[model samples]
Target chain A: MGPLIPYDIIPFEWSSIIAIIIGLCFGFILEASGFSSSRKLAGVFYGYDFAVFKVFFTAAIVSLIGLLYMDYLGHIDISMLYIHPTYLWGAIIGGAIMGIGFIAGGFCPGTSLSAVAIGKIDAIINVLGIMVGVFIFSELYPLFEPIYNGYFYGNITLEDSLGINPYWFVFILTIVAIIMFAVTDMIRKRVKKVFY
Target chain B: MVNRKLVKFLSLRYKILAFIFIVLAGGLVLLPKHEKQEGISPEKLLANTINPERYISTDALAEKMINQDPSLLLIDVRNESDYKKYTLTNAINIPLKNILDEESEPYLNQDAYDVILFSNDHFHADQAWILCTRLGYKNLHVLNGGINSWYNTIINPKMPTEDMAHTEFELYAFRKAASMYFGVAYPEKVKKATVIKPVTKPSITAAPKKVIVKKKKKKLPIEGGC
Candidate 1:
């Protein structure tokens, strides 16, 4: 029956309000889970903690399974859901930059925003740096345009390109995530613990 | 001893995690996959089909054309050959067979225009209408009686007898004016015999011809450039 906005079940005017509510909930969850703590977040990179990995992987699998179940029960139209388009080189370079940023700043965009809400000086600097980066990117858009727009692949799903059955793919992915979680926990136990 | 060791290896938390994964995986594997339905359900389609509101009568269609309603989009659903031979002014040809094709989607699956489908008769037009209707297309209507009705009513209308009701006479007069608007030429005798004031021809200007100027293709830098 959904997406509610596209189907007009929920009017388009309500989208921004709905998005704000979801964003608030996300920030609250991140803060509650100690994600706003730079030391806690950075622990994942240093191998002292695997909370991020466990939480994110659990969230992914839970949402995947839940959406599939909803689709099967005729509650939602899975095909109508938006898929972020793949821009091959753009994604590769952007991800590398993001990964480096995460390591250096000890907080990704969302967690940094959560930290900023609690008046963390480092998070405020990080957010300012993010805005500066965005401004620079916009100013020099033409320079980045080629790589950014190149190798454009239209909105596609894993099932589309890989020719895999969605159910089987999700099942295998869930198993893999479970294995990774257990491995991360073992690695965390062996590593020297760093306390904030 | 093996059971006790297994219990020790898998703690209560792991046990719960494993249980959740197993249940999810079981549901995924056991649930029957239903193929995505192409269009509206049969029940909805049936209800829509029986609705008479979907048909725009020839007179109403003619009236729209005379008024040059911007929202009205006439679709000639006959074959390409027939379309080429004869079609309504500004009407786009989309044969019934190609009604569901990707190329026709921009024309049919839009809310901006009230697209009316018509063939020689109601048959092909009705078929196109049904196909589009099933796909949940909005603002679609079948031109009742199609082009055949248009020709009979607008292009060559029957004059009302002297004893006919005033409304019938008025309708006949309107159709005569519409026929002239569509460039239908009546005999001089018939034209002069009308007691009503002469209907002035609508001023229609020829569309400006398109002039094509091909530009030289410029080669750009290869992709993945810094």
Candidate 2:
């Protein structure tokens, strides 16, 4: 039934407004969950705090299971959903850069933005760094174009790539996530806490 | 002593979280596995089936063609051999079998054009329409009565009787003009010579063939990502 704008069930003109509303809610939730604090975010790497891991993993699993249920009940046509195309080398290289940035600066892009909303000076610098990186990438696009566009595996899901049943995949993933959560709690207790 | 230590490690909050996860996993395990459905629900398809708005009449299509409507996209769903034999001006051939192919996606899935599907008759075109509509394509239409109707109405319109309404005569005149516009020859309009040349072969009045060159398929730019 949905992917409403594509189906013309919801007029395309309202898309921008809807996006703004969703973005606002997302930012509000991020700030409320203490994601705006750089120390809490960086603690995941130090084994002192696992809030980031728990929250994001739970969000992923919840959305996955919810979407599956919705599809089964015929509330939405899951096939109509847009999936971001995968670029293999681009993802690997970009992920490495983002991980380094997250460890060093203590904020990812989305959390940095939420921090900036609360007037954090560090977040402002991080945002500026991100813009500079974007500018550099744009300027050197021709040089990076090969890696950026190479090894494109068109939009696909676990079902397509791994040939696994989505239901079983989600169930296994939930169990793994719960085990990880318990393990992280134990690790946090053993590690010396760093006061922010 | 080991059991006490394990119980102490698993706090109340952890126990509750584990319980919730177990329930959710149980639910997921119980869900019946099915193949991914690429089509819309049958009820919605039925609703679209009963709606007559999906069919565009030949006269409306002819008018759109004459006016050079930018949004008009005529898809001849007949096979290549039949398509090459004769087709409407500027109509692209996307055979019924290949309607669901990746190459046909850019043409059928876009909203920029009023994509009209047609065949020799309504059968093949309707099948194409159903396939596309099932995939939730927008701005799609079936050419009512297909090419046979186009031949009867636009190519060789019957003269209306005197008892018929004025609108019928007007429609007939429009059709005759349209037939001429589409390059139909009238044998009766030819002047007779004193010496009649013997007809070698029986005249077969075929519609002028206009082959539309297919454009190279390019991937459509998809929107909506973070």
DockQ of 1: 0.44
* Cα lDDT tens digits for candidate 1, B68-130: 999999999999999999889899999998999999999999999999999999889989999
Clashes of 2: 0
Which residue segments of model 2 deviate by more than 4 Å? A1-32, A116-124, A138-142, B1-10, B33-132, B137-157, B162-226
Q: Against the true structure, whose DockQ is highest?
A: 2
Local distance difference test scores for all models:
0.85, 0.86
Residue range A121-182, candidate 2, lDDT tens digits: 99999999999999999999999999999999999777899999888898999889888998
**lDDT of candidate model 2 versus the reference:** 0.86
**Which digits, one per residue and each the tens of the lDDT, describe model 2 over residues B70-172?**
9999999999999999999999999999999999999999979999999999889999999999988989999899999999999999876556666776788
Q: Name the TM-score of candidate 2.
A: 0.67
**Candidate 2 chain B least-lDDT 10 residues:** B217-226
- Chain A TM per prediction: 0.98, 0.97
